[model samples]
Target: MQRRRLGREWCWIVRGGQSGGAATPAPTEKVIGMSFPAADHGWLGAVIKNAEDEAKAEGLKYVITTAADPNKQTNDIEDLISKKVSAIVMLPIESAAMTPVAKKVKEAGIPLIVVDRELESDDFTALVKGDNTGIGTHAGKYLVDKLGGKGKIVEIIGVPSSVTTMRSDGFREAIKDHPDMQVIVSQSGDFQKEKSLNVMQNILQSQPQIDAVYTHDDEMALGVLQAIKEAKRTDIKVVTGAGGHKDVYKLIKDGDPLMQATFTYSPLMVKDAVKLAADIVGGKTPAEKVTMLEATPITKDNIDKFYDPNANY
Candidate 1:
């Protein structure tokens, strides 16, 4: 039998079949539950797509749900638990608020794999996430070197989570050694294009002499670019996260003056978790605790290497 956390107060159970091969009759059509924050923006949209594709490819019966609100996410988990899936893959909307859900899944004896944003629990079976800190550190170092170790910079942070905290901390650590480099303005853009644009506009108005801007996501970076153009500011440079977007690649390929670089944090890692979960259910031993995916720095010189026109997001 397989059991997992459903949300906050429920447990999901999955009946197991005889172990060992594809000859084992496909494990009696086991169901896997996937819960993630709603696709309020580009990064999450890609995450959902990756999860669905991976589930289909692995031939697992799956139920997928999305919740942007923490309470709603808890409710969704309860519903999934009632339905009793074998395993659950979750990308939490709020870390602390999801702990009860993780505990419930553990109590039910289901495998719980937390993805992307982490929850506050050791009860989970495994975790899959990107190196947010590394992404930020790389961006910081690159900007520092490009500006000759000194400049006025602005930062647009993502939603409040451990992921954002690590990224911001990493960036700060990298640039802390450079006395000439300073972050004049830092604000939360909530990882949305409109909010990023508005924040950028406000920063421009307040600090007209800014030299560089670092946004946590590419969609927000695009908004920063638009704000810069609207204000007719020619002195600032912009960098962003998520290098997979077509527009980001175009900016890098064409050597756009405004957009200098981006960090690669793939949404495809969600797919990896699905595959790993399927393997474990099929009696294959997989990593027990966590899987960390590396992030790459995408610059004008090597942007073409990651470009995929056929990619949906």
Candidate 2:
């Protein structure tokens, strides 16, 4: 057995030999590839960090790539294929556009494990992600309770992706019971801080009396906060998702009047996906094709539990 260290974990790889006595040993080198969308935001940065940590612990050679454009991502995958890695872990930029790329990976005979986002085909061997709908629903319920089931709220959404749709749908479902809690204006922020700030500014101008705002991501939340301050609107409360950042935890911990709560959508899911890929190559079968990580709401009462100063995210 040959030993390799991955992050904090140790992995053992068994080598095979010929039937004859004193046969040559199998090679000890093994490599895995990981590809994801560029870290344009805080959550994705966390994902990259966690994946690197896991790769180091498992003692597997790792290759990482990121692309802001779908076409670029497709090309990156092709490059990885040429390298003939043992397996691939991908977080697609666009599910539909990346399906063909997934097929190409499968055709190469490399085990494919997708994280966070999914392609159109089921050809992938495994997937690891959080419940986006659940995160949205939690945010909606929290807003309703804070506003006593009646208030004018606005929503700053992420990019137009399947994950965004699921989060939006769940939020609408949770608030359906509160007829008075209406969403006055909703718009796409493209999941960027500056874009969210500009969109939020326009929304404030159009609707002068918003009681609350729900931005799906913490990066957007920060932009929304700045927009609120610039407008001098103290009436509006905020709820966001992705609780890994230090700023978000601090706001909730101190009971910031504007930022009331956030939902946990850990980037550690990437780490889990990498480990699963290693296991598949090492000959361990997982119990399920899809693994769903829980999404928990982080409120002022329990914010202390997740506040880790040492956390990279």
Candidate 3:
């Protein structure tokens, strides 16, 4: 039986099978309740696609729900519980509201696999994510090296979440050693192209000596690039983005000056989470509770390895 929170709910979670040499029973009771935010961007759409593909591969019945708000997501969790799903795999829309729901899932005894964005506490069965901090650090270091540690850079931040904070923190920490590496304009792009474009445009208007730009997300990078083009700014040499979007990968492969490199953050982490949930249901205890995939710095020299023409992201 699983433990309850607030001394109210009770549920039966996974019970590990025999530890001897006996064969593990293959799980045919494949019902996974996946909940995540609606695809507000193409990158998010890739995440949903990956999750769906993995669930299908395992022959799992999925009650996948997309909620734009926490209230809707909370309701989705209740609906999944009512249906008695074997497990729940969720990428939290936000940390605060989702933490209580994640706690409830734990109390319900349903195996919960948290992916992508994190909840408030480390209460879930598994947490699979990319190294967001490393991403920012790599981008920062790359900019510093390219500019020889003396240049003006602008950063476009993402949404108001742990991701935003960690990425920025990592970049700041890495660039701290170089006193000449100055951040000329810093603003929130909110992880959207239009918003970042507007923000970048405004920054370009105010500043005329930006050497490079670092955007936390590929979508935001697109906006920043557009703003630079519209302004006809030649001073900006390198513009880097995180998130290995197909376009960004292609640009890097072609040695595009503006979209030169990006730290890789794959949406495929969603598939890994779904697969992990199914493995846990099959009496498989994962060796690690928290899995953070390494952030690879993608550059034109090695972009061929990552560039996929047919890939969606």
Candidate 4:
């Protein structure tokens, strides 16, 4: 998942194109670097695809790169700089590991768009993200409300980053008022189905009766369910996950007991980043440099309305 070549395949969509005024043609000489985590998992893969999809729709030139590790990502940044791509949009694997590279990109006068995760400082020209804390709060409150404010829950955490912290903190903050609803333990799921499966297995061994599981991501949520199924644990009544993945939405639609709900945390945020980054690279001024979107809770009550059978994620 290192360096991939560009492929453009859509008519441009610009402000002037759809307006009554003469269409402002898309720039041909500019290139936007679409750098992000590897599409090894569902959400991230959708992120990469949607980012590319936007670029295609806008008729923007792009050099997209994906990395499995932060070190490779750093190297990928240097490569983009050497290629002299006009701007960059990155969703870092971790905040601290990518700060130096982000800072360097900013100092080099390249317009940088930081997406989803965050860094130690504001090292980019713009930022686009979903509300991480709000997602956790939604899930936490759902679990509390479902269990009548009293139950044991296991939290499957995500990769180490500010996103993880915000989600976890928000959940705790939301549910702290309920003293009876206790989170029995929190374990790292690493945002992977396999890793969370193993983690869930280990967690199941120690906990006797868990009423719910709150996974920081839907991928991990899927993992937790697999482990529970394998262990034949009937005590878990609900599982709330973050991220608006299609399969999870289907699970809610199908009336699965454990997969009751998941808050909408879309990967499509990257699409916006790509569009704005292209404009910035072309010397256009955007009205805003920072955009943080909120999360929406998707449950059985509204699953059919939100569930898409053919979405990218």
Colliding residue pairs in candidate 4: none
CA RMSD of all predictions: 7.5, 7.6, 9.4, 7.2
TM-score of 4: 0.90
**What overall lDDT, based on C-alpha atoms, would model 1 receive against the true structure?**
0.78
lDDT of 4 by residue, 1-313 (tens): 2233346432221111122211222445566777788777899989888987888777776666677888878877776766666788889989999999987887788889999999878888888999999988888888888999999989999888989999999999989999999988998988999999999999999999999999999999999999999999999999889888898998899898889989888888988888888778767887897888879999899898888899999
Ranking by TM-score: 4, 1, 2, 3
**Candidate 1 structure quality by residue, lDDT tens digits, 144-226:** 88889999999999887878888899999999999999988889888888999999899889896988988888888988998
Give TM-scores for every candidate, taking all chains together and pairing residue i with residue i.
Answer: 0.88, 0.88, 0.87, 0.90
Candidate 3 residue-wise lDDT, 220-282, digit = tens: 998898989998999999999988888888888877778998888899999899989889878
Give the residue spans of candidate 4 off by over 4 A: 1-28
Q: Which pairs clash in the backbone of model 3?
A: none
Give the whole-model CA lDDT for all candidates, comma-separated: 0.78, 0.79, 0.82, 0.83
Give the better candidate number (1 or 4) by lDDT. 4
Model 2: residues with Cα > 4 Å off, grouped in runs: 1-29
- Compared to the true structure, candidate 3 yields what TM-score? 0.87
TM-score, predicted candidate 1 vs. hidden true structure: 0.88
User: Model 2, 158-228: lDDT tens per residue?
Assistant: 77666788789989999998899998988988777789899989988888788988888888888888888
